[model samples]
Target chain A: MGLESIPVVTQSASDGLTGNAAAVLREIAARLESLAKEGQSGIIDLGAMPLSPADKAWLADKLGQGEVEINLELDGPSHVRETRYAGVWWLLHHNPQGAVTGEFIEITRIPELVLAHPADIISGSESLNFLIDDLC
Target chain B: MREQEGRLVASLAQQGISRRTFMKYCATLASMMALPPSAGIAMAEAMASSRRPSVIWLPFQECTGCTESITRSHSPTLEGLIFDAISLDYQETLMAAAGHQAEEALEKAIEDNKGKFVLIIDGSVATGLDGAYSCIAGRSNLELLKKVAPHAAAIVAMGSCAAYGGIPKANPNPTAAVSVSDIIKDKPIVNIPGCPPIPVVMTGVLAHFLTFGSLPELDKLGRPKAFYGETIHDRCYRRPFYDQGKFAKTFDDDGARNGWCLFELGCKGPITYNACATVKWNGGTSWPVESGHGCLGCSEPDFWDGGGFYKALSMPANPLKLAAGAAVAGAAAGVAISFANRAKKGAAKAAHETTTLADLEK
Candidate 1:
């Protein structure tokens, strides 16, 4: 193809995340801080960390737009990714106790996204867990 | 120092650099030195009068690639500018003498400017087998380094070979190759690491030191932060491809020609810290990744032992993930296009109806 062959996404990138991601992250961070005060150690809960709303929105928009198939594949240790298309996000996560491990047990957000990110989980040592990635 | 610098300034003026241009060069140097803009005049004064500092260049376990890289630099014909800028009294590679005369010259330079001249060591020091892997004249590299480095003002480890031991210091190093920092402890040493460092960067550091009388602030790795601060990936033009999840899996694939991200093709750019993307090579033209090769992360410490250059760390998720994403976008675009078409026809029909009514009235 030629230079003009590429389709450009003219949308502004400055505002990818809405308040949802921040609110969720703040809730999670606050809960983690409280849990630490109560003596819970050894859980690096990166998942509890707030996802930048801008990033989420960017991911969401790209899914709503773009070529390239992306999917979250979280299996075994170090398996994590954040992405979706046609208005969806497949984020595989652990429960409050951090014992149960599986894929798709909890659907985090979608269809105008309503979420509650608890903060207690992040209080443990090595609690910060999630690494956001655009799936390819 | 000022008076010595003034003589050089007078020489430069005689060679056609105007006082204003000289000051401009000073201002640029000051900026590169991380000094305030006003420091330019001070730099100008320093350059005008500072006595030419003596320097010693030692070649060790190296391929001479460092010299080639530096010499290839266009701004300062690496040889011409380096010697002109400093009082280069002894260099193993460029000096005329060979045998005892050369050795004597080196001894004289070191003694003449003890604790005042800069010592630039160009390769790693091999410590295995009584340091027999590399030798200068009749002495081992280790012995030579210990003897000559004690009275140097500052040390500039000029290549990855000298800075991080390059390939020799990689895994299973039988020679026990070590960096300049490993050997020299007294004087603060600045490492300019690359397979061979950027010519501009090397000169920039030299100019910064000459102008300000001190080394530039360094990163945790002891490399000048100005050049190694941001990662090559961060400044790359293909960053959008990564964000969009468009990647080239194979070297000669369609995606590669289409200008997709090279992460899947073992691109270490994401983890590599260098000015390759921004500063580029060969006069800001293009680097390896730009010329269509994954980053080797040459500037990072211990890069040679990192992993297979062809293998990528899929630790980070590929930007595009789900198969349904493309389908979803295509479907949405189709719907949008159909809706737009419907609206256009609808307006056209309405206009036709209005025209018919006007015809009846006529």
Candidate 2:
């Protein structure tokens, strides 16, 4: 049979309730609380976890969307979105081929990947000085 | 040792690969290897500063499918980048040098890196006919492996053939092929067993070695526990159907269309341990079971000799006759063995229940 003949079975979000999504939600909650209490940043590797598609949908629904949404174009496209809860962000990284390489949940003020590195800032400062020199 | 060149980070930067992209690649690898998120930064630092590890690939008695799997794995892939980062000193099929020049390159690589480079074996070592079944540059694979395996820091068996004597070592084997482990017992060996293993797995192992300065934690079968710990059945999408006792009897049945479990159709998912279920193939597109076929159990030992691919793993040859015989026997021994049989069956049932409950708890 052709690949197109294969039936696509999409499990409902409710199906996630019977799975490990509740436990994962509880873990996320605990991490979020820790982040608020001690300013501790944490990351949950969603790609490593055996999360079903339904579990992912349930998580997305529960987290809801926040104001901040970012798309990074580097080796590939990466999406960084804030969850409904402050200090909680969802991240998805894809390779240049457009296939997802990793997914994660970060409990922090801002995800680390979105921040500019100090080394880049130093290089930028050098370039700025060079531009001023050329102008003179 | 070869002169210490510029750091990997500087080299990648020269190639237009930024530090941010490198960090992202490290993070992806860290997640894939089930390492802590912070370990991604550590991996990035380690790989950036450290020199590229030398690798010497040795092909033996088999097809070059393993090489194809790694090289042609999704273009501009992180794994591809990781491979590019390595100093592959010698590879037979990929390298341009041939004849004595190729042999000289191999000798030079060994002499330079001796006891430091990673040795990757893709095919099985044929021991039959005084090791004449497979040879390169007038040297038997057996002699070559014996010579090279000693000086390498670690060896990676890259395919089922190199890991467990794959198809060549099947029943009535003519070549008397054997796995790398069977011959090289001293060196640390990691088996990435598959007809052709997933591309990322090879790179993941290499990344782990590069970052940690040692091999990743391996399962009893000498495979990395991160990828090979869970069986295909444990992580399969159709697992819920299997739990509900729904199964497809034939290729085109309604159950098959509904995506029921292929247990009756001889799916070896329950026995095979590999990352195909979750990590998937062809850029995470789909695996064998997802493509509407039973698992061939390529990762397991001696899978070729297990049985016919279409025959159920545990089904009796004649179900109706066996059931009828059991019924008749039960009736004849009703009085004599009933109490004893009930006791034994009750104990067995209790054990079964406990095991099932424990599995559900997990």
Candidate 3:
């Protein structure tokens, strides 16, 4: 009697581009090594990069969400959410009219948009001193 | 034998799992244990006719998560039925007997089934401060284990705690907790290690024992190699994405939402080995990875101390400046090794003598 191996099918392969996805994952792994070892952070500008909707969605689902989330509404509306990767942040800068201006993936402890610039820090110091004088 | 001779078969029939289904389960177990297909029939026959083996479960410095994982896995199903069929002589958590009565029952069962019963232990054995760290029935876990180990035919160390001291044996282990193997040196011990090892794994080991009258082949760490042979990454669904150079930079980014891969998100699937990918938790529903969470690598030894759960296995915050130099050096080494191999081959070829028909005849 002829016999063949009974294949145990756990799941059907529905999503293609798995090979491409794996290559990108390896690059990310290397980047993660760099991020952890050298305290260096780089931004991947989605606006600048050409990625299909499917590829983008695939990346988002895999990354998951991180512990930190920062929301800004000073100028118009800006959203910053950290991905499951501790230092990876998703930054969305909105225009004053509430239109999306830029989208970026920032790899850092804190996104640049939310950080207080040197000029802003000096202005904040002056404002605080003025407030203290007014209170006195 | 006891009245439990046909009890398991009868209960299985009542459960409506069918002989075919029961046989299928046995076959699956056999395959999982890397046994021959014919062994499945043997397992079915053995389980159907043999009386249930007596099991005495002892919990020590633990969280009872192992018990929960086993009982909660596919409850009201065949696995549960098989678990129920086992003659559990004494268990402090599930048994109604308590205090001196429970202790007496444990003693009586050990006496009644000496050299035959299976002693299943969850949690670590505490030896610190005169074993005052964890005491039950006014006896330290170490004391109880020492007393009961000799009478047992085999000892099943369930969960990381019993197998490798688990979290209790993490850095600065306060209780001086040690694994079952640390204490019971003479008895044959099978370690099932996980934060709370996969439930089916526990049942699989039991089935192997009940069928073969002995434990399955074990790896160096005393764990059944069938389940822990491959890393989670090797069997992960998103492994394709990892190979494709696609990663999600942010949680809500397009890459993540599309479920590219979580290697960048500090997934421990690579170095950590377990059956989570294939045997999904909560009855083949979904595991931590499927649910969009990085594997905590709960099955590995000293998982708690492996590093931050969110940190990638061997990554740095910044790129190494000497990476290019290292690559050049690695290439030189590779070239040198290849030249050496070629030289050896050439030398062997030069020394070779051609075989002639006359020489062969001689």
For all candidates in order, state the fraction of native interface contacts they contain: 0.00, 0.44, 0.00
For candidate 2, chain B by itself scores a TM value of 0.85
Model 1 segments beyond 4 Å from truth?
A: A1-136, B1-7, B10-42, B77-82, B315-362
**Best candidate (score: lDDT):** 2
Deviation of model 2 at B12, angstroms: 3.4
* Chain A TM-score, prediction 2: 0.86
The whole-model lDDT of each prediction reads 0.63, 0.82, 0.74
Error at B93, model 1, angstroms: 1.0
lDDT score of residue B2 within candidate 1: 26
What are the DockQ scores of the candidates, in order?
A: 0.01, 0.32, 0.01
Ranking by TM-score: 2, 3, 1
Identify the candidate with maximal TM-score.
Answer: 2
TM-score of 3: 0.63
lDDT of 2: 0.82
Question: lDDT rank, highest first?
Answer: 2, 3, 1
What DockQ score does model 2 reach against the true complex? 0.32
Candidate 1, residues A1-136, lDDT tens digits: the string is 8746644322222344545554543543454455446633111222222334465554345434323233321111212333432222233332222322222101222311122112212322223332223221
Q: Local error of candidate 2 at B207, Å?
A: 0.3
lDDT of 2 by residue, A1-136 (tens): 9756666553322255546777778989999899888988999888876677788998899999999999988688889999899988999999776879899999999888888766667767888999999999
Per-residue error for B254 in candidate 3, Å, reads 1.8
lDDT of 1 by residue, B190-282 (tens): 999998788767776777788778998899888998777778788777877889888888777777776678887778888777777755676
